[model samples]
Target: MRKTIWKSMILSTLAVGSFAFPVPASAAVQVNPVPGLRQDFIKGADVSMLPEMEKNGAVFYDVDGTKMDELQIMKNHGVNWIRVRIWNDPKYGVLGGGGYTDEQRALELAKRAKAIGLKVLVDLHYSDGWADPGQQYTPHAWKNDSPQKLEQDVYDFTRKIVQDFRQQGTLPDMMQIGNEVKNGMLWPVGKLPAKDGGKAFFRLMASGLKAVRDLDPDHKIKLMIHLPDGGDNDVYRKFFDMLVKDNGVNDFDVIGFSYYPFWHGSLQDLQKNLDDVSARYGKEVVVAETAYGFTTDNYDQEKNHYGPAEARRSGFTATVQGQASGLRGVMSDLAAVPDGRGLGLFYWEPDWYAVPGAGWKAGSGNNWENLSMFDQNGKALDSWDVFRDVSDETAPVVPVTVTEMDEPEAEGSTGIPVKLPQSVLVTFSDEHQEMLPIVWKDSAPVYDKDGDYSVSGSVEKIDAPISCDVTIKPKANLLQNGDFESLSLDGWTVTGDKWTAQPTSGKGDAKGEGSLHYWGGTPYQFTMSQEVMGLTPGKYTVQVSAQGKEDSSKFCLFLIGDNGEKKTAEISTTGWNQWRTVKIADVEIKNGKAVVGVDMKGAPDKWGSVDNFKLYRQEDSKAAK
Candidate 1:
């Protein structure tokens, strides 16, 4: 319980830190030059070597121009290693797929890294498409093989790949036999160590491990057993112990875990799990895949895969500040480990920001960019600054992995649930953009797509620098999935709210004004720097506004408290469309900043645009009482 209080305090501090400080507009963060260090763990990033449009087609994406220059950037961020995956006979969805094979893109990137003193870790997937525990289709060449034949093939393929890389001076410092092999590779013969006491999987893994050892038997190369979901130590224990029980597979090097907050548990849980695993097995541990989000709402919903709540519970606030804080938490936990067993980490696809055609969606771009290390325009994020030295003595300038726990919790309960608040009508409206003016609610509202309110399924960005709480309600629609969640530009937050540049087509979307802010409900002004502006102490009615209206533009009004719950309101807007105004004649303001923004909930198409808003003192003054 005491530990819980501290974690909560850290979370709260992170939430209010933004509103408390005066942030610079369009500010570029200063990255401290990471001092040269002899790090035991490999600090790397999984930058996909996108199969070139052609052999050398400009590397056309995020090259030096966009900070996509891997070699230099890795060095800058204290990333000393690069992990590249290899696929067999894959067209990668191009001209019958005349793209990079294992010897192509991976080799090229590996060569580049080696040439620049960067270490490489090679991942062998033996399959054409993505191969995890769920889907591990044997490569075409090995599809027709018998169990023994497949084992031999794995040994040969792995040996040949390692030898080839070694000959090219790009030999891997560490090699991952398979990618997320919850179930082992090669299928019926090599699936995960079965719950039914099977030896097929262990034998297959041994085949790969031995092949790696044959080429260079001096333990010069570290071997890592990769698994998805870091929070589940039970999975690791089950998989590893089964492997250990087998006579064929035992001499592995490190335990690699994937730590994705939305999918994995909190870092507290992860650390405890890691501490236990490494101590028991006597192996090093590295979080091979980790990333935190910088934005709560997606700007271009078409591309990217990060739907809301990507990084909320694990103490990551889902804001630029939160991402920074989250990294700090992970690193600090790593530092506290004994024997420095916590090697380091790799930010999974950290460079996956918004490129011209780079997004998560199939038809659109990938949605993972919102959680990328850099912003869409290739700007480095503030999150990088989170990596710091132990005590400002051992090269404080350089990016250090696993410094001491900054605001650590007690032993257990890192994953303990906080009693987050439920949905409350913070603010409501009938027209344009309607949003619940929430401010740092202990927990974001749970408004699902039940087809009632025009809401947004996106999670609340409840961290600092943007501590305002908000939820864009979705509208109900019979024809489609009711994308009625219109965004409001009121109450300290602004989003397209499912409102795009395109024209409205159905019920959910409509032109704005009525939903978000009340046009003349006094005067609710805004300036991002101030959280609670010192208002002239007097009775005042809060006024609001909305944008993107064709004719009689209307507005809504509401006062909101911290955490995004509705506070107070007076009247509503009925008529006055053509750039006109309306009022909700009542209310008062004591002091501090009054958060304001318009909402375009249920608004569709070119729906929910907003601007020109303020807060005014009520005329009732002394007489209203």
Candidate 2:
């Protein structure tokens, strides 16, 4: 669930905050340097879309408005390494277009990095498109290959790639065998948690490792094993333990973690996991990928991946300064790694600013412009100063105290528990500050009656206690048992096979204590519905948390009014346990009675789970229309 390259790139096409000219250079934030920063620390960027972007009229400029090559601009701003993704055959993509990360494109980027004196890290996805914890469809050409044949193909294909790089005089400085192989790669044959899947995955990984080693007998290029969920120590421990002790396939130079603060966890969680895994496996740890949004504007029909909710989780605002602080926090965490086992980090796709005619595929919008290091006009943002200032090693800003820190506050409907901020921004005596995690006395506070409540909390670095003020208004949800905490569908009308209730303690996609689960040895279609009576007639919206394994299955959240009015919102799932919220909004409730539920038509051997069905008045709902 780390990411989908295609989906992330297909953002929004509409221009936002456009200007007749570039922003002034003075608009960038200038910061003092970090103390004792390492000279060889990896300040990297994954600008794989540079070729496509430039080809489609994208122009890069410095803070001073001087036009320059994107790679050159990155190098000037302290980026010393470039990461490029290589797809086997993008022409076979499901979208029926040439994938942008083919060998030629990757090699071109590598050459550009080399020309600018920057090191290169080659990321091999193995598949023709995106490969992550969720989906890992094998390359179409190798679809019919057996395990033995697949192993041979991996070796041959990898060897040829390395050879091509060597011939071009742009051999990558480091190579990742596979991209984010947390749940393993190459689909069912190598999918993890299965009976024999681990063995098959190890074999395939070993084959790729052999190719890199053979091509680099001198061992000039470092090798790495990359995975998602950087803050989850258990995931790292189990995966590495199995690879090292059980299968004996631990021949790698680095352990790479893709940690996006919002998706992974707090900065404290990241530091703890990095410290543990680096010590446990005795390998160098590098944050392979990370990024934060500088703004929340969606600009078009495409919704941004990072917003207020994600920002709150990280204890940072969606602002230019917030973006800088987030990256600085990451750098500080890595710097604190014991024995200097922590290497450095790479910002994913910093150059992928929104522009017409350039996206993940033809006619697709860019959903990640808010997270780009460049603005809509390709002007370098003030946050880029973090890299420049850190690399310069000018001076350090000391934090003396947090007397001027801001208190936390939020509001929510009575039925649902108000989500307190996980972290808080602490301003110090010198006015230099950072966002730190908060340890609350009462972590979960749910109020049945409408009123205001305060939860006391303490910051790890601050001795003084703080309180978060929450305003709980009247309940907005019109239905009951929506969170599935009852461990059964007591209020839901069930159809098809009997479903299982999964507890939150497990790895199921339940956001609360329990969720509705469905799957069997045979194919099936089912519905878990609820009819709510006596609703105030008006525009309404329903939101449900759900995930599934079948990409072809038609899973939808639907609503029907008493007068036969109907509406449906399709749920698009990336993987079995990677949950996402799906909602049908702006339903005019002409009658007092309305029925809503999940209707799933799953294929044989496929599975899915759902939880947290909430019905809110249209004005109170946050779901995109």
Candidate 3:
């Protein structure tokens, strides 16, 4: 079932979503044999998003009973609980940031959650900023401390935070000691794996968990030890085995899983992992954090994006319909896990939609709006309310007990179509193709003409999520020998402040394709002084693109200031890949070199290939000056 997809480099064609859009076959006639099914049920979304609702004037529980709010709408749709993440003193990054869950906001939202009769689960990430597998920098105040001090801080913070919530009458129904702590957290002193310098990882975890117990004492709290997205059995196995041995394993209650279908493996893998976890650890499982973007385009260019599916999924389709349907399927599968052991799952922050000031990364804002449950304007999306069992606003709830079926089969009475799922198998014939010609699609990632090989998407470049394939295969077709295929923009330089464009690995950036035309040193380098010309008195911006194996290097888009001073806009190219676009901005003037490109690192090397250069002048006069 090969479908026609538009493939291109991008200027601006982003929508929030999960996978490549499976070319819709006009008829429902089968193209291939569908795989086994997951007859799972759903519990609903995390009600923690209600605070955003209140802040937005969208009522969760109307004191005066004014009108139906998203919370009521959610409950009516079958959502039973709201999960809130509690961070310690996250005034700057977590608490004050828009859209992200902060402590104060969490309390506000928790009150709304309780008011709505929604069970609340308090997730505590010891750090004030985002905590995940990749990087878990310690909290600022705790940074300059000994391992013992850090340990006490972790315990005290968890204890006091939980105690405060309890005192406020909004104690979380359950509490997660730390957020996705696979690699361990609160660095420098309490880091996990005890690697680098933080030699007290396990002890650090103990300190925190102990604190939770100290505060509660009753042991009623359902403690959770969350790891990264589920589906990676090897990673989890290693992590769990280490925890059991080093941390003694009894510190937590529930096994927290964060499953994102696109990044993680298939539902089959997920089920297998869950069963394995429950069987191996003898603990209950809860999908602590889970979500799927309604679209792939960045709704707000100023903030955060989950990295659109197009930029990540070139092997299978990452579409809104697919993600939603996948969510339904995931829920259903979890329901069927042994012993109702699959308790429930929470849709991570379904209320995080588009808002004027909501963003994640600094400088760029609102780039992830399309990926949120809401649009850029903060309005809810139809997709946001989607639930397999109780999506319909007018749908009647089938009682948990039925006279005929014995158990609760009330959901069967409803006509909610079972979201048919297509299992993506890594088969021989359909081996993940690296050929861009076969892989590219008609999307933001595929920024060019539909089904055509696009050289560059646009000149006035804005950051867009990039999606492509890997260059693992050793073989290539003619032209020149190379091992990788990379995203290259046209007018952009090979190296600049924003990125370090690298050479194809003696081959194209992507596999199956020959050595790319402008990939390596053979691909001419667009140097400074020769690239930029016009300038004005206002600020101007030019986004730089970089890709490939060679990551570290210096590059910049330079401009001569009115004082004849040489100023350059440098974007951090610390972590460059073929799948993202970085922006560059600096003041410009009517002079020489308004936008110049230069490789600051004098050492000769193939950094990366940059193309689709975009120039945005603050004032229109700058464009003409």
Candidate 4:
């Protein structure tokens, strides 16, 4: 979701609550009251490819064009923590394929991060390759082991890794027992809904947790259980509920989630989910993996994974400005968590530039080059500004009370003025001198054709910025079966050979019975169009949730006018497995009938799908102006 950072001046009356104090035994005694402060928000990055990029002749430079050590550069950008991932045994073993994050390689990286006074977060995949919601393969050596033996192996391996770090005096400050294990880990033995009575999954996780606790006798290392899809509260609630209540496993310090905006949901949804999970579990939460593309243009001949298409789907342009804005939105959301239970965030692989010989697998050069904080040329991008101005120490004290005294009034007639809240009285203690008053800057006016209209005010404080959300209920959707939950292409007219109804994959719509999948055919052409009639539209927005299979494919949403004119908005394939919203705004539907649909072309090897095609007729309002 696109967010605006508003700056406004505030004039407010201060109301202070009176308190009675009891005298201490010694009037001259100096005492420090308990600090009513949140933990220092962590700003971190996963530069697992730092060593490989540096070794492959990639030189990093600061914004001023002066060359510096990469670690120092990150440190200079307000980065206080670094994360490194470790695979059990890569295909070519440790130090092969540009040091593919084996145990030793991870330790080296951790030591380097520590050398610069950066805390380390260790991510253990427990597999040879990637381990996520879709796939979590067991190590080759333990693939054939029995359930009991695999649990033992998990304990042994975790303990050994922790021991190695402890002996080197570089134990990680935080350790993720598993990386994005949404479906559980260790494949068949410990997979979710475990065939063997669901005990194996918890046993494996318990083993890992025990190993961390046992190896670090001092209990300095914080343990985190990570899962992907940070916006899905159901996934987190169900998984953790099962793990803790049903499976009897509940010893973890932090709840980590991977939240790539394109793949996940909007920033608002993420904020809601984080708030719910934090309040429900009463545990610290962190966005373990997040990144935005700086540019859609490829810097190297090697196929870039996150290109222009991916950037569009990410709801941000593939520009340095977009990267900074996206990161700012994410960080702001993380910091807005109620009671400050939101710990912080980590940008995944911010240093993985498109350097030769530094690829995920053999010949698959850096797919995440565009998402790095540094440019393809190894020059730091403007995104580092997110880390430059660290202000955790300066956050204003929480307000005691901020109440909306009066609701805004808007007349139904045209040219009628709608009165909105001008200011709010803020109550705070005398110590909170730096706390600024809340001011109304702008508001989103919601208007429905059915005569339901409301306005949401946007407020902001300069010093300690926080989101002030005003709920506005939206109008009903104009299009039928927008979610495609009927399991049939009842309203859509499918053209070309590849459009078919299939089960929805990835995230986006709760009613996931079916979706329209369009595979690029031999001639590379496909379209799914739906006609919506009976609409008096001045302006409308066409939105669809979609995902693609490869970066080369183009998925577009178009509004076809009655006279053959078309307004189109398209997103290139990005996070193909993760669903994202594609929206075309301000579409002037002159005629009552307009054809709304998606078109797929180019890159026959790739396929794309869409669901939840919604059309909303925007009401003419003064607030919208």
Show the lowest summed lDDT stretch of 10 residues, model 4: 15-24
| lDDT for each residue of candidate 3 in 1-625, tens digit (9 for 90 to 100) | 1122223322333221211112235421101211221223335465444554455454232222335566675676457777777655556555555345667777887787789787788887777667776457787778788877887887777777778788888877677767787767875455555654223777777777788787777877777788875887776788777777545757777888888654565666788888888778878787776766555455444423343223233222233444444565455556556766676688876665554444443333444344445444445444432352323324322111100100000000011111110111121111111112211232212111112222222112222222222111111110111122222121233433211232222222233221222222212234533243323235655544544434444455554445566666553433334434555555645543343444445233444444333444545324234
Judged by TM-score, which candidate is best?
A: 2
lDDT of 4 by residue, 472-589 (tens): 2233355645665533344467666432223232233222745665543233666778876655546777888876675665668898766678999976656555778878877776
Better of 2 and 4 by TM-score: 2
Clashes of 4: 1
* Candidate 2 residue lDDT tens string, 384-476: 877776655444343222334557665556445555666665543222335658899987577766678889988656565678887766435
Q: How far out, in Å, is residue 51 in model 4?
A: 2.2
Count of backbone clashes, every candidate in sequence: 79, 5, 74, 1
User: What range of 10 consecutive residues in model 1 has the weakest lDDT sum?
Assistant: 425-434
Candidate 1 Cα deviation (angstroms), residue 545: 33
After aligning candidate 3 to the native by TM-score, how far in Å is the CA of 297 from where it should be?
3.3
Q: Rank the candidates by lDDT, best first.
A: 2, 4, 1, 3
Q: Give per-residue CA lDDT, model 1, range 1-625, as digits (tens).
A: 0111122222221222111121235422222222222255456777653443223332322223453554566566556777777776564422123223455678888888888888888878877656665566687788889988888988998898888888887778888888888767666567654564657666667788999999888988888888876887888888777767544366788888888765576666787888988887888887777887777555554533343323323344456655655554555556556677877777777665555444332335445768877666666665554443222233223221211111111110111111121211111010001112323333323332221221122224212122222222221110100111222121233333211221122111223312222111111222221123433344444443333334332334455433354443322332333233333334444442345433322321222322333444443234323
Higher TM-score: candidate 1 or 4?
Answer: 4
lDDT of the structure predicted as candidate 4: 0.67
